[model samples]
Target chain A: MKDLDGLDLPTFEDVIAAHARIAPHIRRTPVLVSEALNALTGAELFFKCENFQEAGAFKVRGACNAVFGLDDEQAKLGVATHSSGNHALSLSYAAGRRGIPCTVVMPRTAPQAKKDAVIGYGGRIVECEPSTSSREATFARVQEETGAEFVHPYNDPRVIAGQGTCSRELAEQVEGLDAVIAPIGGGGMISGCCLTLSTIAPHIKIYAAEPEQADDAYRSFKAGHIIADDAPDTIADGLKVPLKDRTWHFVSNHVTDILTCSEQEIIDAMKLTFKRLRVVMEPSCAPPLAAILKNPEVFRGKRVGVIITGGNVDLDRLPWIKG
Target chain B: MKDLDGLDLPTFEDVIAAHARIAPHIRRTPVLVSEALNALTGAELFFKCENFQEAGAFKVRGACNAVFGLDDEQAKLGVATHSSGNHALSLSYAAGRRGIPCTVVMPRTAPQAKKDAVIGYGGRIVECEPSTSSREATFARVQEETGAEFVHPYNDPRVIAGQGTCSRELAEQVEGLDAVIAPIGGGGMISGCCLTLSTIAPHIKIYAAEPEQADDAYRSFKAGHIIADDAPDTIADGLKVPLKDRTWHFVSNHVTDILTCSEQEIIDAMKLTFKRLRVVMEPSCAPPLAAILKNPEVFRGKRVGVIITGGNVDLDRLPWIKG
Candidate 1:
């Protein structure tokens, strides 16, 4: 399925194939419910705990699909990506499982914990300046040297198809969900949800949540086209990226709405989830919950599914705690 | 069953009955596994996440059993306990569900987060000095004034029976576990494991893990009798209480060994678990994993079920971070 821009869009078939290809590698993460959260939101919320997923994020699903789907010759060439977050670790985890070489182009200023995680998964890190031009230049040189395939953090079709498997599992695990909301960064996760739900259950509304500090997706939704941002800042570090053409296709065509919440709201929601759901998740996973809490009128009396995107937090610098 | 110490010990049959009684009130928490942790320790570790329980701890199982088992006349009196930990909030959670009043006599210096949780769950708190004598004295006055039944934190057979249900579920969830380990704070959770595993899966050995700073349980195990500690201190606050007679009966008979770890080891294990397992657990839950890492010979090449006792820590004061 190719879009008007000639870029291929993933279909329901691709999602199904992704599920089968990655089933052996990825965990069918559990969906948990908290009565306390339900009471607070005035809506029953089912949390898809991808924080418990292999490599501690839903990104592993796509990473595994991409790595394992490679031809024998392509496998020998290895895989590469530019990410200073969960994707870097997740791709490393997937590549290691397949016994292939993995290279990550990470910003020199990325947290030591994240760098350690990628290396712990048998990944080699190449330092890059903390800028898009520097990252792309470094990544291109590394790819030329190693002949490694580039897997965009969220812009690739294989990754979107892989992410779609999460919603499929959620639909099977739960019945009669009225709406599903997920935090949108490059829109890989939310786009995946949009792809799967639009095909199998169009009645189920799909909503995207974003941090107010990085509201490019929300503005793009309002304007009905792609809107790219430059160096947006948010405590949700993973959500600072702008959506590319592939993800924007799903966001513009299928998503019902895009909601945004403030930095303080994101931190509060993250802490409430820690306190009530008793789960450890990152700030990127909080915006959907924050939006749900902030706009109760839209969610009241409905059964909502909230995707907890990842749990790669730096415990020493927890947002709510002072140094 | 009555022991020579003139105290009644809970049987496996009691565990079965307690399971049926509290099934509706508690969560059948998921058992999680981390390949990274397994590789690190050279053991197949299955973590039963009781931190995700209804009141954020396994204590809720016993609290529900005790609160719901009261006769009509006793029900009118409600329930009371003396503690500044999960027990206070758990009993309150169960009592609130049953529409009964719950009172807790807690040390004035207990963390504000814990006190807030108890009050949030509809449990009334009475402040006392941070000493056993003061706690007992305050508890007696509250019991006298309210006529509420005194539910000993871990000494009661009913409470022990409720705790046993956790292992029964573990035994059903995972097959052929060579051993089981849990932190022994007054031996409530360990006693419960002993009661259930000793009957249904006698081939499996039960081990108790304790912090060296509060090693009364470990010392008592070696001394061949109960050795009450006088105000021992540790980062693992939940394990500071000395084992009472009822818990000692189960620990002395069914436990294979008692393992102890340093305070630093507990902190390290807690942080490691938070990073690897992506779960928020209290310091109390880390001792078992710490002991497993410290004494790898006992657990290596064995299937081990580790009980993550609870996840009720104050996020603002995480042990690893400097204030």
Candidate 2:
């Protein structure tokens, strides 16, 4: 299997540059220290609350960086992408800020709240069946018809660099972090974390927390090969993506471990978040929390950082709690 | 009705002193800025997220201050209070930290979650009927039986000084705020807000937001007399307190305006808070937001500071959205 050596890995300097560019456009989301969570796991926990970021997700950092970094001509041509939810809303918001057009190819089964958010931000939506093949086909058709530049949610170099800015800020926000854990979907967030952490704090361990049902990244990392889910099913809608070649390379090279957590554990952690932290997080955003709770032996006594990547949960579809 | 004269009025210096003393015990809750809210209301809004504070509300600040400020004899007897919800949990949490026994007189109608939280924190409960007469009589009986020092929820000087810590932090967090707004319940929050603003930024205007259905403070401000609700009815369970003499005096002297918002407006603002800000705010916490939304012209083009006071909403009884 080919490694990430030939890929254009974002340098720490590049992430720093991206941070500066997006600083004016995005929020420096708060880093919260949870005493209750720390007491529960016996570890000092630093929660990077990207759930409070603009558009209610860290995807805004990447989306804003990608849209704002474009050349005048490319930006004028506008951008399009396919996403489950967070990335689409983020792209729409960023594009709206720049007065540029944004079109999103979303799954027909995507939450109505998310669909409304996309349209609310002036993004044209192209709905397709809930399958990778259909999403790719739909995105291709829309891109070809509209002559819009493709902004692959996690595959593009610019998007990866853009995502790396989150880790750059995290590394600066807290000190003495023994490890940083983030949920892996298509590996965009983990890849960005790896690139930034390796360059600045190379000794810090980087782990990926994946849902047990969608453990392709975990299997791929362990077997020294890229793996795809045969038929994925998880309540963590944001983490449904199968890894791409570029992201897989980065994960293969830099991520220290990939941890898997159960759906019940995810729900339990989401409830803890709502009860203690007062932030509503989707299932995917709870994986790192589940990992820390279930396997405290690994994270205990260490300064651990967890990224609460998004809080765009549909109130009507909240999996664990009933209204 | 006598006003808070120069001798009795709390100065910014007093709040600063109280803040310094209580800083170690209280959570320095973060200030979150919402671009989505800003665009919606055309005002730059700064949210002081006391919902994320320890004990799940700003009440802890006052509770801790009141509990810990007691002299050795007073501390030995422990403390007691009557509350609908947040204050009971806060007082319990504070008393627990001091290794002292605490009792809470609560209406039988208080939410189960709040009752559980009070017990979970080790506070003994003395349940009474929903009316003020019954609550006061029950509290008197409990106080006489146990010899526990009664800590009034809002009327006490120490509690008011403790609540002032929130605005002191806010004054430091956001510069040049044209005005500050907080939900008025027992008038503790607004009284403390007035004290802090009058002391630190005398030029900054202060507004009290109240539910129209339970507009005791609004009526009092308008009629130049204390107005107790003849039939208090609102979904904002936390803000149903009739004005106490001390709080009413402070508010009349320092508060610039007391505005009333309809129950529907409060419910709608709560929904927006859950959807956009991802914070689960109870209806009382939504009053300031309701004020901002209902009278956008008053706040438009201004830097407005809003205190999101608590997040003790029972998901099962969420009033705004139909299940």
Candidate 3:
């Protein structure tokens, strides 16, 4: 609940430190420049293809940093977290690499691909009903039973620092970006991107693209208060989280704007990404592209960076019309 | 039908030259190493991801090389070819870049995605019934009508020279690969690979994988005579071609073996590739993985190179499961 001001805010140095610490454990996923996309949007776009990252998402950076940054005793106790999909897979992969035990509390509705990925990486899963209350109760039970350290998916400072490593690499890879747009789920990735951009390239603007159906963060950003949605319905299951107090502070201070895209637009962009870029991206990952495609005038002729957050779409339930 | 023995084969120098010619026009797709795959298959696997190559296939290498290799007068006439899918898209993309006219004779059964890609890149499509006889007849009519130069998808020397550039880049990327395995359709890619390896590293064994249902190339290699299957049925639609005379000669002289995998094994391998590698591969592209999984003892402890040739899978009619 502490405000992310003088004492709580992460400096550029902290993000740089996080980058160095997680460098060995995480991959520097390639930044692909799409001529097709740029020509369509009229914006010179650079896609930071984090979908190609280990565990098929950017969560590995933060998860690896959080688990490895722990003290020896804390590391011995191992780490526990709750996630819909990407975070669990990343935490499981990172923890597995360090030979530490990991337990992930996931919604039973989470995609089978993600659950398989988490299990494949040797993580124990505790499934709960698809509700926030159920998730919290299950997490509490698991934490008490194992006496493990909880690495909050987005709210914790360590996770934020780890996530910031993505933007650090982006800033190092491409210079003079006018802005960076990242899809927001629990605010972990965007918070990290903001922190890194603020330190490394303070002039570069950072934006968050939220699904219209799950626009809690966008509403909260405009209202200057934390917003919680009772039951959001959107294809981007990843971006269904309500804003947390810690994430609200970071999001309010660091992010330039929180934009919303329609579910249909997200689906169209997802299809374009798969067909043209030949990369599998879930609906949440398409928000940045959606924003650029819908509001080309706002981003035209500017050097825009977009993060393809993940590629864990279920083949059977693909949102786009196939063949 | 001219004997390839008297006709000079492309040397590694020729491949290297072709690479320089196409380098500016093509992408150097990533070479991904999978520790998990290596552990599962007992082989050090280096996957040259040509699925991520320009136009979503390695066919672009040959298409670009042939297009650019043409004399000014010949190029003025433009080019024409017949393909099931990937080759049409590649040729369209290459021709579009060169500002030249291109005519593609595609089977009516080809996936809509492939047709869209070809059209999107400004190629004129001439649909033919799904058979070798119909395709050849349609292509001949188009060639005669347009007075366009013919670029045979597999049989042309220029096209083979272009495809060789993939192995040239692969050899440079991964050092000391003991062998290279690629799926054999018309034997264009394998012929090119063989031509490159024979001149650069003659000791590096080359293997061709063919689906058991469409094992004409495999039988041809064993019998010391070019074999043709009048009717072949397999999940690997890309490997349905009967070997061409030129390619058969190269396979007989240079390739160490032509391995066969079951349709079920190919589907399983395709699913594994998507799950573990986060890459969408068609059944033909998964043949090397099937070979490694089915015959682990053959590749155990050896540095094996697998060319993921293309990723033009039809999501609607996925070879593995009906959606």
Candidate 4:
């Protein structure tokens, strides 16, 4: 843990500055409550809807903060990221807003719709083999070739600080929240919640929900150290990545517990969310709600804030329907 | 025109009263704007999201007003209605809220999901043949037996007043809107918009959108009279019903025009709304957006308010997907 001392971990003040930096580009996304979901969970739940974000995810908040915070010289070189999902689209959107170039290093095998969306947002694509080493190698090459700032999807301090803005808004929107939960992958969003709520609303307990198939964060929490998983698969594809040092610092210290749910539970929770909340969100956003529904005793009678992280999904292949 | 002298029409004052009366029951549904949509349509569109209403449709506003407006004696008998769609579900919801019995006379062939939802809201369903005459006869018999006060879905003054509150909210939520558009489905929502906008902001033009497959309202507006259609088939099933006298009174007088789009256009607009707005609205909500897209010259450089009327749809049968 002492190794973190030299790393520039973001503080609450950084979160405040990040909020100010990205306020113009990001939405103060609405908080929605459902009587039916409340009755079913035995908890009063407040859903912070980042799905309605212009870039269709909470990732845009971090992307905008990173893009807009760049000084004139750095901004001229532009920003780059390796992602096949919302992060790619969000970063492209943010860079486009600042009139800077965005280069995405994505797998050559990625869906055409996703590639088209990134290009639609004015991002240049650099194709890579669909593997961890290949993606990292391609990303490094792209950064070296272009001298562009590499924006890690969730690991960067700036990204965590920007993500903290969501919980800050959630706390302001809903008073007396006894707990807050979010789906955790690389822990950018959870780290942000930890950073913000620990400073401003320490009484509120923070929890991270993960897909059972990709429960490295849960294992890490139990073993009192970081646990890395290689290519663990789950329908909640956004959560397949491993947590890094900067995110691990917040997850270890502030998060009260890490919870996991089965894939079927996630799908059920997703369908229920669509039916009850009447919002279209992706699979990654379902784990928190699934955890709550699966272990109602943990959330019962508490005022809980659930982060619906993103809404980017293929409408044709909704998970609940048979292929 | 003189025939309307004896008919009771809801006024702006009634809209105010209805707002106050149903304020506790209904949400001040948020207005959403999409920059992507704006870029495509060339209009600054403000979407009034009644789809986010607790009962999943704007019909809840009207239903709540009717159910809550009943006096103690009338409440004792409860409420009755004949509908095969949102009104049946909405009235059931409102009646359940009021702790009153709700009897719905629905077609025997209506989807089981629809029937289950109505029953879930504590409504009693009396099924009849899936025809206008059989539905009316069944409704008449049920009303006679139960002594429940009948609530006409769109043609009643109370319902019109309740629906007007949606536009009242929109008018307050947005500034300097040049025009407001909503799909014409028996004209309940559009009539309500006309009622509220005519009194509060008459300068704002009111446009009704209709599917070409069931363009009776458009024909009626052009013909300068009410034109009733019998059992027209369209993907926008909600708009197949013809406008009644009460709604026609508003459409013939206050509505600026009724625009029509083909069935394919409606389906395309529905997909675009889901993709751009990240919302789960039904096909009935698509016509207004379709009309706007098809006639871009009409809405370009204008601030347009689009009423997304409902979100209740079968996920398995999305219009854009091949069956």
Candidate 5:
């Protein structure tokens, strides 16, 4: 909880501080439980529904932390990020809360609903090619032009500390959770979970759920090094990013294991969650449930926490309703 | 809050009894609030989400009350009901919990999903031709053969009192609501709201929302008499039946107004609820929201309670997705 290299990397103390700083700007989303889902999966599941969060995702936690933690002069200059999904909307929402300009670079192929949400939250979108190089190039140009503070989606200490607040709330909301599972995208949420659970409830296991199609996190953990993917295609669009050093520190140390699920499994689990929990969430959020369903032995007969990461999908183009 | 007409007709006292009797069987569903929704409509709204209730609707409260309220001799023969929706599912669920026999008579034209749910909950289903005369004849024969106690979907005092528990919880959860809106079908929920709110908080306006395509409740409220509709088609399939004597007693005496919304407005409101609330409520539950959106002048800047009725929907057959 002490100085972790002058806060360049967040410690448990930093996450606790993030909770205090971002508490006013973000929502204290409720934890939901479903008997039908518990019966179906054979696990006592507690869902931390970040889909009900301000920007419709857990990304808001970190974004709010980063935006609000900035010095007044730095915050006035604004914030910039590159995200094709919930992070863009969340950063925009956080920036809007502080009454500052937000610049977001998103892939042109990103869903129109996500783009609309970012714009609705008062973000200026800088469209980039779907490739990572184009996105970074555009992001760099925007940051330079706006002179905005650069806040990486998952690599920054403030954002990781911010996401840590979710698990802190979950640990307090549900007693005796045997394990906690969160879908790993750029490893922000899982790292945050590791950051908090390691410091507080060290006995609890942390699992990172990933899409099989975009399984860089799984591969990286197995290989014992960072394995970057350029453009991994999956129904879970939010999880295509590779892990960086800040996120890797926690994933490599605190996480018990990284689990993976197939594209069909993700879609089916998502449909089931929608049916039983009656909560509308995107495909990216479904991997944790899919992992539990696929490996019931891992989660059976235990109190487990499942984080529903986001709920910003175009209803007109649900994966199951094939055109 | 005393007894009226012996123990046969439910008084406000019956609602209090129902709340205690059914407490062991039903869920004390959560009250949700969405800032985005409030910002859009300018109404400080509190949603009593019965969509998350056991058997996926508030009918479970009534069904549980009816099943549990029966005496030793009456419960021996078990219960019977004729419903094409949530009531049938609810009765079966309650019966399943008590380990008793339950018989449900349904029109052959009812959705396969509803029939499956009834059977899944251990109820015997007898399908009849999709006509009022045929349904009545079939239901009579089933009850005669099975010797089951008839629990009418919305007409019976037991069911009305059971539904009253919802507003009771809402009153305890959120304070000083200017109005409460519920979608009306056979006037059961609205009547329950009337029964509870009139006694507990007489200053709060009670509004009944009805689909314009099946506006019998709206017409009957204006005419100051019960106007029975045998069959009326609407997307809110649950709100098609006519008001009966027990429900009419409360609806006529206590309800402030009956509001109607067009089919298109209902669908649009449903989509909005799915997007903003992140809960998968059926079309029948969308009328309160639709009415609020259409009549913001009446609800603007006021604290309003919106009851979300049910979540038993077929995802494959979403209205926005054309075949």
Candidate 6:
């Protein structure tokens, strides 16, 4: 099945196929439930701990699917992306495992640690200006020169199908979830959740959690169209990207609600999660708990599945522990 | 089985009974392994994650056993302990769950966060001096006045039996571990490991790790007697206590070796574990990794089980983040 945007939207079958293809590469992250967190939120919360996934995020699932699904000819050309975070690292990780080249077009201002991570995973870096136009232009040039297939961080069908495996596994691991919540950046993970749940467990409501400081997805949902943002500064750095065509399809078609929480609320939720759950995650992943805390009425008695999207964090730069 | 001190040392049968008795009260924490950490150490390290235990430590197992194992009349008097860390919080947690009054005699200099945790868990705090003499004196007065049962942190047989359940679970979780290493504080966890492994998996080596700043366990192990220290200081605050008689018997008889690591080495190992495992563990839990890293030859090519003792830390005071 293809969306109206002419992109091939992978079905539940495709997600199943992706899971089988990438099962050997990606991690089957455990579902951790904390009685303390459940008591605090007044909800039965099941945390899908993708923070323990390879490359430290669920993106590795999609990256592995895309890399491993490629035919020999296409695989020889390799994979490329414009992400500066976990996606880039994951793609690099996947491509390295397959013995193929991976190129990352990152802004020159990207953190040195992230750059080193990409390099550590055998990724070639193509530095661009700190702007979307510059990033796209550089990515185009790199793809053209290297003949590398461009994998949009969230918009590709294979990537979406790969991410959908998380929810499929969640359904098998946990029974009778009233709703599922995942952070919406470019809407990849939430889209994957929607794709999986809408087909396998259609009774389950799908919710999108977004940082209020970078509320592009929230605003887009209300406006009934896509709202593209260039460079919004938020502590949830992974969530600054705007919704693209493929993700907008899932959000518009299946999502029940889009919730937003303030930056302070997200940080508080992150700390509370660490204290209660004993798991370290990036700020972008805390928006689900933030939304739950802010609008408890929406989720008060529900058995909610929260996808902890990632755990890549700078230990020296905790938001609460200020310099 | 009773020891020379007339303490009825709980046998492997008692550990099995304790597991059945305390199963409902405590969490069966998951065993997590990090391939990154394994690669770094050149050993297959299975981390028995007690940090995720209720009340945020493995001490909850013993605390729950002691609190719940009591008969009705004895339970009416409640429980009391003289400690300033995980033991206090865990005992308070257990007591709170069982609807019993618990008293803790803590040093006046203990961190406010730890004190708050005990109070939050419904424990009454009696402030004492920093020395063991002052602590014991204050605890004696409190126990005499309240008629509460004195559940000595590591000296009691029930406590050792309670902790022994961790190694029992580890033995079931992972097969063919060449050795097991746990941080030695007052030697509760190590003694428990010794008690369990020495009985069932007698071939497996038992190693006790200690911080160099608080090397009473190391010194005592070599001296062939209990060497009580008065308020040793280390970043691993949970391990500052000295060895007691009940723990000394197990350590002197069953332990294969006692290893020590410097303060900075412990902090570095803690940071590395956080980075690689994405689990927030306390400094007291890092000595095993420090020992592994400092002496790779001792652990390389072997399958080792490292017990993560706790995760209760003052997040505001992370060592890597300079003030």
Q: Give TM per candidate.
A: 0.97, 0.93, 0.92, 0.98, 0.97, 0.97
TM-score of chain A of each: 0.98, 0.94, 0.94, 0.98, 0.96, 0.98
The lDDT values for all models are 0.93, 0.85, 0.84, 0.93, 0.91, 0.91
Q: Model 5: runs farther than 4 Å from truth?
A: A1-7, B1-8
The docking category that best describes candidate 1 is medium
**Lowest lDDT block of 10, candidate 1 chain B:** B1-10
lDDT score, candidate 6, position B288: 97
User: Which pairs of residues collide in model 4?
Assistant: none
Chain B vs. true chain B: TM-score per candidate: 0.98, 0.94, 0.95, 0.98, 0.97, 0.97
lDDT of 1 by residue, B239-286 (tens): 999998889888999999999999999999999999889888999999
Model 2 - which docking category? medium
Q: Candidates' DockQ values? A: 0.78, 0.52, 0.33, 0.64, 0.78, 0.76
**Model 1 pairs in collision:** none
Residue pairs of candidate 3 with colliding backbone atoms = none
Which residue pairs come into collision in candidate 6?
Answer: none
Fraction of native A-B contacts kept, per candidate: 0.71, 0.50, 0.19, 0.48, 0.71, 0.62
Q: Cα miss at B274, model 4 (Å)?
A: 1.2
Order the candidates by lDDT, highest first — what do you get? 1, 4, 6, 5, 2, 3
State the lDDT of candidate 3 residue by residue for A1-323, as single tens digits: 12334436555576777888888887888777656777798988888888778888898888998888888888887899998678898999989988888999998987787788899898999999988799999999999998889987787778888888898888889988999999997898898887778777888988899889999999999999988998899999889887776667678888989888999999988878776666677788998899888888789999988998887777666776542
lDDT of 6 by residue, B194-258 (tens): 98999999999999899999999999989899887877899998898888888888999999999
lDDT of 1 by residue, A1-323 (tens): 45666889999999999999999999999888998899999999999999999999999998998899898898898999999988999999999999999999999999898899999999999999988899999999999999998888899999999999999999988899999999999999999999999998899999999999999999989988878898899999889889899999899889999999999999999999988888889999999999999999999999999999998888887899989
Report the C-alpha lDDT of model 4 over B30-76, residue by residue, as the tens digit.
Answer: 99989889999989999998889978999999999999999989999
Against the true structure, candidate 1 reaches a TM-score of 0.97
Q: Can you write out model 5's per-residue Cα lDDT over B177-227, one digit (the tens) per residue?
A: 999999998888888899889989999999989999999988998999989
